[model samples]
Target chain A: MTSAFWAVYLREILIMKRRILRQSASMAVSPLLYVVAFGCALGAAVKVGDRSYLEFLIPGLAAMASMTQAFAIATEINVARFYFFAFEEFQAAPVSPFSYVLAETLAGVTKALYAVLIVLIIALLFGTRLNYGPAFWGALLLNSFSFAALAVALAMLVKSHADQSLLTAFVITPMAFLGGTFFPVDALPAWASAILRFLPLTHAADAARAGAFGLPPSPLPFIILACCSLVFFSLALSTVKKARN
Target chain B: MIKTESLKKSFGRTRALDSLDLEVPEGELFAFLGPNGAGKTTAIRILTGLSFKDSGKAFVAGVDIDKDPLKAKRLCGLATQNVNLDSELSVRENMDIHGRLFSMSAKERRERTRELLELVELWDRADSLVKSLSGGLKRRLMIARALSHGPRLLFLDEPTVGLDPAIRRRVWSLIKTVNQKGVTVLLTTHYIEEAEFLAGRVAFIHEGRIVREGTPGEIALEVGKWAADTFQDGVLKSSFFADKREATEFLAAAPGGGTLRKVNLEDAFIHLTGKRVL
Candidate 1:
């Protein structure tokens, strides 16, 4: 079981190693554009709390990057399932469903961490220095873990490549914009804030922003993110087993 | 090496396998001869632990698949009908991963990969991406990957489904070589000659049940030694006889001239089911 886990992870690492340059560039493009457009051009006149808006936006951008990059693994899974038929190879092997899901989810977390590193690099270049403490890292890891697990479960349920795109459009896109990434969720109406509180990314963005600001860590968001991770990971295991049958 | 008794599987209202029973002894090259939709792939999938059976029992390499699927799976390797190789990776990487799945050491994996690739005559193209290889090369690589773990039993489902005749013959030779090395092989194919040429024992499956099972010569003898095909009013009619002289006499008495040939697995299949294997 341990060997099979590493075997599956090794394949992903090899593929990522070959495409490192291209993937790094792709990861950098969005955050770089967001810094230029929202942080530089629009932030000169606005203030978030006592600091400039760039400082606040940087942590939110980090939160969003972790979500998107982690969820991106579903595209790879779908391509393997629909076109290359590589998932069938694993199905025919002796690898357990738990090992397969764990390996793929870890691969997704790896990609998410890489994207977060790029965001930090961009933040440094923009003169927005934030605290890099354990709380910040914890929130980011939990966020990535939750979304990556969700990606695997949804990848198994989607019937075709088109359905995957629809999932991204409907599920991930809405969460990205409305999950308190661009602005404060508390600034919205009471009803809207109540709804957004249920989103995992909302807690992630809040915890990440608070950690970056060097504020006292609150355990509520961490607790919520951890619960979400466990639920999604369990769902991933079930879906993969169902796919095998 | 393999056995199944009263195995059954169904999808909705359709029965993919129904009360199927089979046994392949160690070191024997067996063939499941049937047309499409005859439950050949389903049976292989169930036996290999890739699928679930509705009822009945299956054993591989002395392991009960339902009770201990991982152990059974480790004892067998399957080359499916589709070319399911990781096209983005090189041939060596593909084989290496399969070895790792079976928990082979790095040294063992390297040695096995080289040995199997050489056996399949693919040593020279080990670094080439699978997508860049020809259809025949991909099939050969799949076979080599299947054997990289040194499995006691190998299941090949339509290993030569869409290849040219010359390439198909080359694949046949590879399968024969693997079987010669003492691996129990269970093959499924619709190609009549593929079974007749390679399998030591062949089972004819139709609509998810085995109609006949025996050696190629034994099953062919069940129909006849010779076949005479005559066309009357644009329809082809076939008649089988045990003696060459009897077939010649029947051909002579036909209203129109016909072709005479030796009986094959297809003839036996058509004689039993009244349908062509194709």
Candidate 2:
């Protein structure tokens, strides 16, 4: 059983990697358009506060790239399992359900990591003026893993592939906007700020910005993010149990 | 090596298996013959420990499937009806991964993979991608994968449902070779000829019940001699099989017994299930 668990995990990683590579052309093209259009063209016309709009937009683009890919990876993994082939091979294998879920989560997180790295390299090459250290990388990884778990948990609860697209519109897209990826939560009304504070990505972006600028994240927000991650991980695992049953 | 006592399973409003009892010796080729949607796959899943039984008990290789599924699964190999091989991997890579799942070391995996590949006549295409192989080659690869870890018992569901006649016969020959190696084989198929040719003992299942169980010839004999009738003018003529002496005796005594010929498993299957074999 131990060997079976590790074998499945390793095999899952390779499968995910191949899938990501298949989408690599799109990944490369889409991000270039976003960075070039929003950062170069729009930056020439608009200024946010005293900073160049392009400079301010670079961080958000990085965060958006990470968050969107993370969600895509998590959601597609379960969708493939349930709707495509029904995981017939894994179902017939000796591996346990817990091990299967763990492997999937790791695979999703790794795919998100690949997306983040590709986008970051592009951002750097285009002279997007990013100043962040290892601390920023650490926060990005944490945010990706936590969000991947949440996405997978939600995906498991849904019964149809169409529900995934619905979720992006109703849940994921709103979180990105409200999470302060593109604008500061404080710029919104008081009630909106209060609501946005509950989003995991808000805390993640704030922590990332703080670390990148050599500032410290508020301890309270850090605790909140950690607690939210734990909750998401637990929910993901519980959903796996329901799915297997 | 396998036993099930009043095994039962239900899927919502449908009852898949009900009070079914089965026993297979350590090394026998047993076939489960049934019509489509007749609970064949459900029963096979329970025996393989891949699904739960609503009630009763199932044991494979002395291990209770529900209580010790891991142990039970380790003792058996399963080939599903749908082709489930990873299309992205080569035949050898697929076997290597299967061996790794069984905890075989890399060295052992290579050796066992070679042996199984040769056993299936797929050694020449070991490095080719599964998607590039012909249907027969892929099916052979699935068989080799199932035996990669040297499992004592193998379970196959609908092993030859969609193959051409030539390929089906080739697969049957391969199955005979595997059985000759002393491995216990359990298979379910709608093809009566395949079962009649390869099965040592056969079970006729219909509506979640075992209608009859025995050697194919035994069941055929017990079902009584069958006859086909034709009409000539206003009279009906029939032909069938009976003992040469019995035919003479019947002819001398009463005229209604009719002529007899040997009955095969297909006739027996139709008699017990009352369903035509496709």
Candidate 3:
């Protein structure tokens, strides 16, 4: 089972490695823009908590980057489904469903980590040193898994590139901005905050900020993210079986 | 060997397979002939563990497919109709990944990859990306990848679907070579001549069930040795005869001239199912 999981994972890694420059470029754009357009401009004017806005912004950027990169698996999955037909390849093989899910989720996490590195580099250049502790890594990982699993489920439901793009546009993008990636959910109206609380990314941002400030995020966010990951993973699994039919 | 008893599958209200029973004896080169949507692919997918059967039994190499899918899948290899190989990967790399998925050791994978690539004559293009290869080469590589794990039973689902005649013939020879090495092969094809040339036994499927199945000669003999087809106002009426002498004689007596020819498997299929295999 482990070997089978590695087989699927390694295939993605190999493709990513072959096209690393192209792959990296897709991730590079947002960080460059965010750091330049927001970080430098707002650094002196704003204070987010006990620290500078740049420091607070770095973790949020990391959280958002990881979330988007992880969820980018949906686009990759759509390509495999619509073009390469790799999903059918795995379907025909003797691989178990759990292994397939594990492999794809890992691929999403791996891509998210690569984005994390990009954000780290940007932070370094901007003279922002945030926490590099276990809590930070753990929250980042949980955030990746939840979003990646959502990507897998959505990938299965949508049939075409246009539909996938619409999902990215309407669903993922809204979640990215509203989930407190760019600003504080606490600043929003009570009813607006209630809805944002339901999104996994909202908790992810909270957890990420806590970790960046060298504090442990509340167990509540971790629990919610864990439940979300499990639910999304289960949905992806059923969708895989449905797609075969 | 492959066997399915009362196997049923449905997608929504459309029954793709309905109590379908299939039998292929050990070491036989069996061809499943059917028109589009005759349920050939659905059956293949179910038997190969890519899809689940609604009810009933399917076994590949003696293991029940539903009960032991992974174990049964281990005994079978499928070269699908489409060129499903990863286009970005080299020919060898595609085969290597298949080997890895099946848990082949490094040395075994290396050696098997070499042997199968050479067998399919893709060894020369082993280092080339699959997308860069011609259609024929990609099909050949798909076959190589399917065989990398050395499965006992091989399923070729319209393996030569879109290839030109020459490349089709080349694929035919490769399949023959593989079958000769004692692998039980179940092939599906719309090309009637392909079935006649390669199949030891042929089965005709229509509306999710087998209409007729036998040796190519046996099926053809049921419709007699000869047939004559005469067209009137874009409609063709056919007549079968016990021999060419009788067929030609009938053709001569017909109101309009008719084309008399020796009955082939396609004629036999049309005679039995009233539907063209294509």
- Per-residue CA lDDT of candidate 3, range A50-159, in tens? 77777878888888999999999989989998887778788888888888888898899999989988898888998989887877888889999988888888898997
lDDT of 2 by residue, B154-182 (tens): 99898887898999898898888988998
Which pairs clash inside model 3?
Answer: none
> DockQ (Cα-based) per candidate?
0.77, 0.42, 0.74
| DockQ of model 2, rounded to 2 decimals | 0.42
**Which of the CAPRI classes, incorrect, acceptable, medium or high, describes model 3?**
medium
The alpha-carbon RMSD over the true interface for every model, in angstroms, is: 1.2, 2.5, 1.0
Residue-level lDDT of model 3, residues B137-221, one tens digit each, is 9888888888889899999999998899999999999999999999999988889999999999999988899989899999998
Candidate 2 vs candidate 3: which has greater lDDT? 3
Clashes of each: 0, 6, 0
The model with the greatest TM-score is: 1
TM-score, chain A only, candidate 2, equals 0.86
Q: Please, what are the lDDT tens digits per residue for candidate 2 over residues A1-245? A: 56776776666665565565666766677667777887677667776666676666655655666677777865556545654342655666676766766666666667666776777777788876466776566666677767777786887788777777898888778887678776778889999898998887777777766665566556665677667668877888787655542
lDDT assessment of candidate 2:
0.75
lDDT for A80 in candidate 2 is 55
Cα shift from native, residue B143, model 1 (Å): 1.1
